[model samples]
Target chain A: MASPLTATPRVTSVTGASQTIPAAAGIGLRAEHYHALLQTRPAIGWLEVHSENYFGEGSLPLTWLERLREHYPLSLHGVGLSLGSVDPLDLEHLRQLKQLIERVQPALVSEHAAWCSVDGRHLHDLLPLPYTEEALNHLVNRIQQAQDFLGRPLLIENLSSYVQYTHSTMPEWEFMPELARRSGCRLLLDINNVYVSAVNHHFDARQYLAAIPAALVDEVHLAGHTRRVIDGVPFLIDTHDQRVSDEVWALYRFAMPRLASVPVLIEWDAALPALEVLLSEAEHAQSIMESDHAVTA
Target chain B: MLSLPELQRQFASAIVDAHAAAQHESLWHDTLLNPGRLTAYRNNFRINIEDALAAIYPVVRRLVGDEFFAAMTRIYAGHAPSRSGNIHHFGAHLPEFLRGFAPTRPLPYLPDVARLELAYHQAFHAGAGAPLSDVQQQRIAAGGYADLMFTMQPALRLLRSDYPALRIWLANRADSDEVPTIDLNAGGDRLLIYRHLDEVEITRLDEPHYRLLALLAAGHRVGTLLNAVSGPSAISRVIQFGLQRQLFSELMIIENTP
Candidate 1:
């Protein structure tokens, strides 16, 4: 028998042609809201989804994604590329990602500037990487390799680190821009992650934004974080569970000028509220970007 | 000047083994803060893995209750670490883990139920194959029934258990409020787990029908299937049901070789 993969005549392109994402706020698409979003066809600017969620084949997830692709432009935000790992890149993961990109033709594809696996065992959390010349060189090579395989430049988002590296030769803010410049990749500039990591480590969030070259930034992320008070010092964890906190929103406002008109996504992964809640957050972010544009215009 | 590999290996070790943190403290900025801060990572790892397991094995969780399931998942997560970055691929080992898990020894049926759930999960994600073309169907219809070979759909799965796992699964769903009174003496179950379009279904099958699909699942030719079956009606019924439910994705007429 012929292979199942070739059993059907495949549609090579997305139904509605892939379009460039507008410089407005979009909500992170989660499984819980799939039906509601598809049914209502809400007035969100665009949608972002974790690339790994649709890694599997032949399911409601893929089915809904196919239908939703027609209605909204998509951004494939990956959490598991593990760009900083020492192990040889996962070619299988890359192959699946390539397949997804072909099917969806997303406007932008992104992965974190962190590693999650080592020696073939996947830790599943975005683990922090020490900032060093060697680490930077390894990451730059990996990003280039991934870009070569995918035939598209990826937007590498900075990680929300819980702790800082002692042996690091430079700060994360400096490390990210250098990595992006060397790798020929763009920056995702997750503003919430900047706030979370800044509070976790004693650093100014503004300095982190200052180091990123504005032209290289293609996207911005806004999400909620949780405050864990350990030893009376509040450590912010990028939980993505609650509403976009007031402090993170403030940081986003600061980032708006630097990011210019980059696409922003409001990501809420856990305890997802009604679709209206996410839409409202996206609207709020869009208003901020518009106001910034108004000032610049 | 630790290499990138060394740092990742050490960091992964630290996440799994709390004792390994001190040895790797130099890798972090503050050795004093590393232990507590790193504990948060450990918690994240556990939550992510546990949540993946829970998503796949909701019925198993319901059957064993939440607290027991949580404790089981903690041990399972540490012992059987995920091998893939995709969370959906994380809990493939849960069925085997439950087979050896001592605390759940009293619930001997839990392992098979987990196996059933895994089958359902696999079916849910299994790739879709094109149904046999009209010309191919016509050829199969004209060809000798005993001479043809068939291929099951990629989304097809057959599972047999010594417990009423299907019933137990149905009773434990979120929509089910009344506690189902299950009789352990109800004997074994043969389940046909297959995906129709996007929805996955688990159906209990009779022994003969189950045997037929099981044989077809193993790539046995239709002639061999007829030989193993007791009656022609059984063969016809299996084929009809298989086609109706989309059990087989393709049919082939084997060629004679010199």
Candidate 2:
């Protein structure tokens, strides 16, 4: 949550297009935690950051992000906007985002399935969408619009939902693959969310993974979650604050092998720890990916 | 637009008005044990803004303890619902919020502190302009100095607060340990927030200096800006004093080519 701001984030990577994306595990780079990351330069596949974090003009955040971007392939993840809303997209947000994409030249860009605004009023949370055909078509068109505007493809992530829409004729796993196949966008499969959704909605996580087209998946997310029980029924929330749980880790191990070598990220959004903690998590995923790659190679 | 407005309103109502039933009940389980999924969204809203406030006003949060600051956030957020999807733009009005906040009114310096925080946030995201180095100054002819215009960096934030907000901000930085108590009767601050080489710097300024620089920044000519200063010494002092801080990296003269 520390400032990961950019000074002139109109462009990201000069070599982003030339370099091929490697399938490996990385950590979400944070601003408060930058000095430690640089001091140690821990072993990990790469590092990812929120695109909006580095929107400053010549601030320390931008300098540090540029330093890190040089050593690692960067992923630009967006957290703003109510993307699922029926309103027209915020042009200013898109302009800023397009500017950041040019500045960072990130290897990958991703946003959540949930919307964060309505009209001009921002709810500031990733609100869920029902998995109805109407919602699916709406998302497909939105994805196409976003891609056409940005002049590139994007990886759309599935939101972790506590409520299942009765109007939904399908699970997000089903809706998502169709979205990718139709819209030409890719999927950022968050393993933890799959685990959370499986438990909350009573489905098999592997089955959901199986439902996704292998080629459609461009990235994988492994994050921690918290569970609270109400009336003896436990509901898990995707609070990216802790280490990846063993159950979710197992789910990742199951899901990762299917996707083979997709880039995996370790996301810890709350109560963000020191750089070493996040780096270690990143290294753990890196080791898994390395081991998998070794066996495949 | 209507759909987003209605959805946002319904989402807002569901979170802010506990008595209102969720319009999208189909999304929840049909059982009696829904046990408030709205709290998740509510907490998410509060937490995100609280984080934004922390980003903007860490000094304020540190000064008022976490618990009191959180209570303050609830009051501040309730009155100032965010209007932008970009969370960075969420807390722009916190200074006004603190000025009217009943509990925080006791901390006479709180509103100014909030102003400093907002200024820092503004400075961070402000546009990136080409640095006006002295080399660029060579392009301007001496005769055209009066008529030559200058463009200030977008990250610059000019302010006058009723407290030593700059010193307070420096003393209360996340890395600093010096705790300074501020007296309510103490005089205010005139400060400028500008970024040089990616580091946001908050420099204190005098009245004439503040007025002259702000005027010039607002695109008035050197003659007008000088005239606006109260005294004759104001012009020279403003230029000399401001030069010591290095506000301009470049200055190009206007050449009317007919």
Candidate 3:
């Protein structure tokens, strides 16, 4: 039987063509930095926001988003889709997302490869998925349904996990690309997540990056992680509160050669710093991307 | 081997229920997983929801200090696990939760404060709509005012509380350095919370105006509201106030009865 992802042709919007984000570097547009971002209009490639933040009918966030959209391309990154849940999908959530897509017409729309809810209860944290065929099949179906509903393709990002399921048959690196292939979705590979999960689960970060086919990757996310000792065991937490660590920067450098021309985003959600700090981070990523482009060219 | 659903069910249980973690320890890939690692996921779950609640109800957190607020939210989460994926919608039941909570009994006004905060939060995110146009205003001026039905803006939230919740909220603002001592006996407040342009505005409404606006917000026709309230002039003044504040998004002229 043909997979729905492959069988169904990609749907384009009837209203108009959506803007495409440049294959450069961008930063997450947070509420704290709205005024600074609007006034400065920093030379970043694009801005990404949590889709749920603007899901309200009308608000300051939506108003600011519209203003920012005029200055830069936008990407709607969703955290609440719970794409891997066993329960039926939240059509209302999907409908709101579609409405946002129409209003903002963001260049790229993305959601996590993990689920945040099960049994109709939302944990609101991106929980890890077991790397098994059954889990893989479920995620693919949900992603296809979401893609069809939005009338656009989605970029599924890898999540940082603290626990590896005993029943998982494959590694996350393999699972991610397979998900993209089967679901007809693109990958928003988060380098920090790869590093965090690799350290937590005892896998080589390079191996995780090596397994991803470059063509499947549409964007990259680099964020900070904190090291904490829990019950005498140390783990890397994807906190996104501080600067991109040296180790993650090294991993991005390693991944950039293969991910040439892929847009990269510097995400800082908690304890957001001044807008200048995020803009500087994006500049650093842009330099790395440009250097890689020079080498490949 | 557990199926995907079974693993998720157990995993969610372990994260939410502290006792369930030990039972689900065997579900992890033992070679790499440890008790501490599983606890990390559990901690993340709690912290994420708590942070969301804290964001939505900062004044509540300020009123009861961080430690108390944290404890309160932990219990609240267990009582009402978030039903929506959007964390913003997670704390809607908090006002009701605060009312029943034992620790907050002494602070009798806490729940009302929470209600005001919730209204402000809702007003901040509610949909925008154009207020009644010049033509509609002209129609109202031409008389037959008692037959008009007004539709409240999506952004408008009318809150009436026995406690001075608005003053309590104002005194506890993060930007306000000096916390003023508020008199608990100062009397209740009837507030009009709505988004004006990009900012959320909260105005204290007088009793007569509050009663009339409250009626209109409840979808009561102007004729019924006039019968309920004293004098046509008071109703007219409140309607004019509502129009000035952009409280009514639309207006409909119903049949005039003798």
Candidate 1 regions exceeding 4 Å error are: A1-7, A293-297, B22-35
Model 3 is docked with a DockQ of 0.39
Of the true interface contacts, the fraction found in model 2 is: 0.37
What's the i-RMS for candidate 3 in angstroms?
13.2
Candidate 2: segments with Cα more than 4 A from true spot: A1-18, A57-59, A292-297, B1-9, B22-35, B63-65, B133-135, B139-144, B170-181, B230-237, B240-244, B249-258
What lDDT, from 0 to 1, does candidate 2 have? Answer: 0.73
Regions more than 4 Å wrong, model 3: A1-18, A229-234, A293-297, B24-32, B256-258
| Tens digits of lDDT, candidate 2, A1-297 | 112112222443455222445787778877777877778777667777887777665555776777777677788898875678777887777787887777767888898887776656677778777676777788788888888889999999988877654456777878888888889989999989999978887888888887888789989999999998966878898899999998876766665566667888899978898877887787777767655632211
In terms of lDDT, the best-performing candidate is: 3
Q: Scoring only the second chain, what is candidate 2's TM-score? A: 0.80
**Poorest 10 consecutive residues of model 3 chain A by lDDT?**
A1-10
Each prediction's whole-model lDDT (CA): 0.83, 0.73, 0.85
Alpha-carbon deviation at A204 in model 3, angstroms: 1.3
Candidate 2 lDDT, B1-258, residue by residue in tens: 123345446666666545564555542334213426667677777777787778788899988988887777777766877777777777788888777778876677888888888887787776545544444433332333444455576777889988877777778888997777756567888988887665778888878778787886776556545456685466556555545555653343444421
TM-score, each model? 0.94, 0.88, 0.94
Deviation (Å) of B206 in candidate 1: 0.5
lDDT of 1 at A127: 87
Q: For candidate 1, write residues A13-65 as lDDT tens digits.
A: 45583478988889999989989998999878899999998877655587788
